[model samples]
Target: MSSKTLISVVGPTAIGKTRLAIILAKHFKTEIVSADSRQFFKEMHIGTAVPSAEELKAVPHHFIQHKSIFEPYSVGDFEKEAIAQIEKLFQNNDYVVMVGGSGLYVDAVVNGLDEFPQIDSKLRDSLNQKLEKEGLECLQEELLVLDPKYYHLVDIHNPHRVIRALEVCLTAKKPYSSFLNQKRKKRNFNSFYVGIQADREVIYERINQRVDIMIEAGLLDEAKKLYPHKNLNALQTVGYKELLEYFDKNFTLDFAISEIKKNTRRFAKRQLTWLRKNKNILWVDFNTEPKVILEKITNQLKTNPHA
Candidate 1:
């Protein structure tokens, strides 16, 4: 068995996942490969919550802010890129850290993605027209009816994710969830999952606080700068989406910020929902000290050396 292992640090947003990942990276003297799809765009910074400059310098990081909002990037593209980066890093270290709240991207790196049948472009275009005619919630409701399992797990606010799932469901005449985990492809390195969780109240509070901090840190100005490109796929994320709606004069600024907090809490709930389905991850309390968590991880590494 290969000794190399990828420690995937996953949790809801504002749960200190980056802190834990950095500690592990330092301990292993290794690098980190980010799987958060939102952090991939160069145009989005404060809204996506890219790591602080000091954090990036503390350890070498990859796949963060490496692309433009205009460039087309998908989970499949990320899976390929992350695997290649991990292979390169594994040449010098036995363990590398992968951290992100984006469960699909993290899972794609750990368990190879299921092969999706080719979706018809016209069908996708039709969905887009429907989205335009109605709104994001229209397609979100349709997806809930078609695939509740995925509907609960996905960011229903993301038009791309919702429409993509709908396209597959409509084409295959089955729940999009049914096609997942059909097979787990083999990889050269083992994977160990570490998840952090907190009480619901605690998680929501943190998310609310984080949103306020982002606002104070000039999130509105950043969103204003990207207002022209709000139609881009990368701008379809949570923090930026609500702000973009504000730019469209859909509501008051205060209401927009509140919506950001509300939507972010819902997003975190969905994140936990998707993450809890994986039985292999060793979940730790969000407030657990770094040394204690590190001790648990090291113990697992020693006990299950090959896994």
Candidate 2:
């Protein structure tokens, strides 16, 4: 039997990754393992742009809404669980699909996470205090100054991410980017990347439309329900954060919605920045037919049987 392969469908949000992954999984008669970190929480549905009920029914999906927001699910946890799930799936099928926009979680499963030295607890506490007192911009600015490369690739609006990178920079006196991809751990299965690409204007339009659809589907109500737990790491995302600002009277609802669209675009840009660094990815037009994409993937696999 051939060694198992992991087909990672990666792209910016709202670029139709879910649809493409489902098509590929169905073609391969396999299941999907979601790497979208925000989609892991059950409480965050519409905001995370999780697969619709119809889409989920079209293919068996693992890791989507499999955890609660109250739980502290780190990238390491996701990497372990995702690998276990993929291994189990490979027992039944030769190929399994992994899809998401969260580059860190995806890399955790693909390249393995880079190990960092343990910083002092006091340093974390001090950073948290600074974040709470001075705001995310303060931390973001510091990160940009300390590690401009990582700043371009990271979700700047995420405080947890910003603070984590800053902690490494401050402690090690080195740019956080310096630690990444220094060494890659071997995996049992072969990995293939399929990146969906589109024109910048088209991608932004798709994101704006998706945000509008989410609003129509009651994203505000969903955000309101999760607002009380806004401080939680899982809730510190694009849609929820903007809505929480409205709930806090810091911005009008109209302004908040616009902010969500703007921030989501920025998030997509960051995702593309991270993905572009991977020169091995097989880029395809976003509108390419599923059958064509599948054929391309299969041909690549055949030509590089040892990959």
Candidate 3:
């Protein structure tokens, strides 16, 4: 059998990754396995920026809205499931498309996740208590001091991710990043990364526009329904958290919307930081035509055919 390739379409949020991935999937006559962590829950539609129904109909997509917000779906679970799906896909197609803005999730599927020593249950419970009492800022500060490297790389706003890293650091007595990139699991397929690029100003403008669109599409109502479950790890993301604050009377609606835009911009910056570190990705302008990018991928596959 010929080797299979996993073509990863990755970029910051609101950078047109979904459109490009769809076009590429159609071109290759294959399905897409999403790596976007936020889009995993069935309850989060508008806030997570899930692909439109029409877009989803354009290509068969797996792993989108496949789980519930109440369920515990870790990156390890995603890595296992995504590889299983890709293995099935490779039986029919030589190339399979994987697209999303979640850098860690994407890396989990491509390179395999790092292993960490088991943490003491008391430490985890203590950290959870600290989170509830002192707020996420306190945990962020602690992580900054404990593992500055991972702090810079991680989504500091996500309490689950921040606490997870801290737990690993405290238990292993080493920086959380020290465990990363230690060893990669061998897979049956090769992976190639395609990153969408844009100027900082343009990216921020697009994010603001997307936030406006989300609000106009009744994101407030969607978030309100999930307000009771705000404490869930899945709801700890940027969009829902900001709007939940509005519902809690913590901020005015306008202010909450503004915060969403600002935080999204910061999230985009962190995404770019993570993606830029990968020297192997073929970067393309956000406005570049899909066919042009497809041609680039074809050339790459020609040069490195073996998976």
- In candidate 1, clashing pairs total 0
What does candidate 3's lDDT look like per residue over 1-307, in tens digits? Answer: 3478899999999999999999999999999999999999999999999999999999999999999999999999999999999999999998899999999899999899888898899999999999989999999999999999889888899999999999999999999999988688888888888899999999999999999999999999999999999899999998999999999999999999999999999999999989988888989999988779888889987886642
> On a 0 to 100 scale, what is the lDDT of residue 303 in model 3?
88
- Model 2's lDDT to the true fold? 0.92
lDDT of 1 by residue, 132-191 (tens): 998888899899999998998888888998998999999999999999977888999999
Rank the candidate models, highest lDDT first. 3, 1, 2
Q: What's the lDDT for all of these models?
A: 0.93, 0.92, 0.93
lDDT of 3: 0.93
Q: At residue 59, what lDDT does model 3 achieve?
A: 99
lDDT measured at residue 19 in model 2 versus the true structure, 0 to 100: 93
Query: What TM-score number comes out for model 2?
Result: 0.98
Stretches of model 1 off by over 4 angstroms after superposition: none
Worst lDDT run of 10 residues, candidate 1, spans: 298-307
Which pairs of residues collide in model 3? none
